[model samples]
Target: MYIEVGQYLGQDGVWLKNDETRLFIQAFGGMTPEFSRKMRSQTRDYWLNAHWMPHFKAPFSGRMDNDDPEQRAYWQVELLRQAAGTFPCAPAFGPGTDNIPTHGDTANNVWSLASARLVDSGGESYAKAVWHLAGEFELLKYQKTDYLRQGDSSHYMVMTVENNHDDAVPINMAWHTTLGSPFVERGCWLLDNCQQYQVCPQGTEFDTTASLELGARFESLSDIPTRTGGKSDLSLMPGYNGHADFISGVSSSRQLLWSACYNPYYNLVYVSVIPLAQLEDQVSPSFMNYWIHSGGREMMPWADYDGGCDRNYALGLECAIGGSCKGYEWSRENPQLLNKPTYFELAGNSTASFVCINSFFSPEGYGRPITGESQLTEMIEQHIRSLDISFDGLQAR
Candidate 1:
């Protein structure tokens, strides 16, 4: 395995690569220079800015004039929607603290590289690195370790959060993995083991053209209810049709949770796997959040209606441990629908860890979906065995 370190959107990031594929891990912000410029070009009068911009005196700051607790809370919830990360990134949402930034301190602050090196075990080589970041209030610390093996496409990651306070604290976090461009074309299919799904109640606020029904429930992603009394085949990514939608669901398999995006045109698939049983007890009720942006947002950075760019075509397959991306309060209030607790309590002076694998590979056949837990596990095992990598603890159930 080879490692390349650099800065991504002003935050420390690293790229882990082998002969087969590569994966990038970075701090929350994944904005490109062009995207940043376009974000800055939006007028203050736009609905997005008008509703929340006045609350913050500066970018990514808590300084605000509003004394009302409700207004302040609204600001925190809206921050990530306005400015979020792209590609594979971690965005830690609440324990619902006012002092913390929108996506917690980890998302807003830059992380420092603690260590990086290559290890040789059983004649097999792999790369490992540790990255750390401290919260603004210094109450919690974030650490992430990445493992990439030679000649393997899969990248394994372990993320830990330590509570510095004397008392226990609640935490909510997720991996905001995104796919775009050639990999997410018109015919791409989203394959998952989720048994149920609920449409996001909060639709894209700036997207006036959005058509998905809020709070709708479905049994599969392939057939989702729409606002127009029609069923949408969400499994297949459609052409730019000026629409956007969000949905959240839970996988039926608790042992191994997985989702794959298969692009028939490229004969490639990007898979994200989370071994839920391997994670700490503090992380429970794992959920998958799917966000589709197809030229619906007409504000500032996503002015798709203006026709200069088609930057809004992307899919976010976020693997989360709490209630979708909703903050702590919303998650707590809406637990009945999800049938699981949206937040977990972490003991003081203790650390809770979560693990996941993100990989990119070309499948043997065209347009064949990787279905069921057994098949997914077999594919991962085969890939690892082919690389001659011995990952003992992560065996398939």
Candidate 2:
């Protein structure tokens, strides 16, 4: 299987990678022609965009060249020669919370004019496809379904949102994902196991199984522990959420649960699998939620070879619908964040199904994340069931 969608750097993205590992598992963003505004690039393509991360934090912070320390070493050596995955959650998927959300929830309309049509991968994966995005969702005929496949090392996503509109649509899904682990240098953790756990802004609680690292571990920028601990917590420990202030923690398991973000001395991992009752909407009650982008420049430089060191650092994830879901009428008025947001409902015309699993690991397979011996999140679900990229009758344009 050798999959390729079209137009890289120019935007409308999708690429699987094989011509001897081009090193992309999923990709998007075409440099010009308005680039669909999906990740809302501008500010000079957010300083030459390529997953630059919806303006590097919060309603698009855009750091106006952060006091030109040589343009932050020329934009961290051009974001390691062009971003794709480390922009992480600019708008890859939304409704997790930027506060005034709910327009496609975020990511510039959840990847606005984005389009991918490989369909017929129902033929069995080389990169089966069906990706379209355009959701305002007020009246309710909105659309955004991303059904993709390509396994054998994993990448299977099925994000469906169909309202068809008879009226009754207020679900704020989430996948505001992010991971550019490269060499996370022994930081980033979350695996408090789960039957239910909530580790946010210091509202601590666990039931056993813990490994929660990362609340700011810069490695450079003078190793930012919130600038030599002058207060402002940066949060991972030591009292929880602070860096810029925005912390989220969740863990719930009725079985089929997972929420990972690992870099244990650079073993590398990014696994997300949670069936969560086929992803909520039996009328609310979803699970999984781990968001912490830590405001005010925690780590926003990509690495300019030693003198500046590699950058494009990142951290953000959402097993989502795990609630208190930060807004949208306050996650629809709490009831425990509306039973924790993973939303699931279609039955007016028909169509309601959900599944999730996103994987990317490196046990010296050369994707980075070195120094391994297994147990880095259990080898990322053993390469996500050995890339078992099977779609199993997925349909919903």
Candidate 3:
């Protein structure tokens, strides 16, 4: 493997490539610009004054005057929030989650911070990155007004999290996993042990042909429905809903599981696997979520909505923890609903962990690796070990 340690949008980043594919890893891997410029032109958090992060901010849409400085600035905040809900940032093959540390109740530092280093030996290369709550930097854009006891937190385990649905409690850790927008398009498809499940509409205005249950036989991208809605659809609403009207659910077995997607556009297939054995695993997500985005709506926020994969669209296959991105409280409350562990903890950390792998299958793999799910599965089983991957510095035994 060949590695390039460089800067992405002024943030530290590493680029990796071999004969088959190329992938970018960042210190701030999952950070997205506060707003959308061109969906295709989005780099990993490199803008000068842009606030890129994975935040749970409110979403907004509709026409705004670009010429009006005040309106533009105000919309920028909303756009960033909307972008956070719509796009996944970077690919960090380690332990991280969405239950961010907050100053008080709801005040959170949207940007998840980390420092990543490249590890390479022989012909194999991987990333070794340490994740942390932002300490030295001013975490929030503004300060807390109320009496602060803990001051500002750099870790959620050190903070208090609460919801009306669940009790307010001292939280320790959560299961957090997500893959951003780069993994979608024509030949891009997710292979999982999915047999019938649920589909909950995340945003207020979401339109999907998806039934409450899905079959295991997904052979083509077109086999899936067009997730984008038209004029009133959230996908076309220009960052209006941060959650992006996503639909998700667990397997029929309803156990912690894994899923893999093939990205022909990138000449590789990405896998997101999760572990949900411990009750301390606060957040438990559905095995997968298919997030839809309209590149046309993103580019022209003021223009009319364009549904489907018109210009630039993304189909994200998410493997979430903490109740499918609901966070610690939700997972803790719903432990009885999840599958018990068939395997022991693989990492040394008390926090959530999993194995995420990506492999390059040449476009010319033809029927061998590209045609059938069994062929691809065997290929992954064979090559995944040679890659030498780890989630929390603990190698797979």
- Which candidate leads the pack in lDDT? 1
**Candidate 3 Cα errors over 4 Å, as ranges:** 1-5, 10-22, 26-29, 32-127, 134-183, 201-245, 251-256, 263-268, 275-286, 294-312, 324-355, 363-397
The alpha-carbon lDDT assigned to residue 348 of candidate 2 equals 56
lDDT tens per residue, model 1, 77-146: 3333234333222324433446655556655655577887777765667787777876665467778777
Candidates sorted on TM-score, descending: 1, 3, 2
The CA lDDT at 140 in model 2 is 33
Give one digit per residue, the lDDT tens place, for model 3 in 127-206: 33333333221121111000101111001111112222222222322122233344344444556555433333232223
Kindly indicate the candidate among 1 and 3 with the higher TM-score.
1
In order, candidate lDDTs are: 0.58, 0.38, 0.33
Q: Lowest summed lDDT over 10 consecutive residues: which window, candidate 2?
A: 30-39
Better of 2 and 3 by TM-score: 3
Q: What is the lDDT of residue 370 in candidate 1?
A: 59
- Looking at model 3, residue 90 earns an lDDT score of 15
lDDT sort, best first: 1, 2, 3
Off by over 4 Å in 1: 7-12, 27-97, 203-209, 279-285, 304-310, 365-397
lDDT of 3 at 307: 38
Task: Supply the TM-score for candidate 1.
Answer: 0.75
- Give all candidate RMSDs, comma-separated: 9.4, 21.2, 12.1
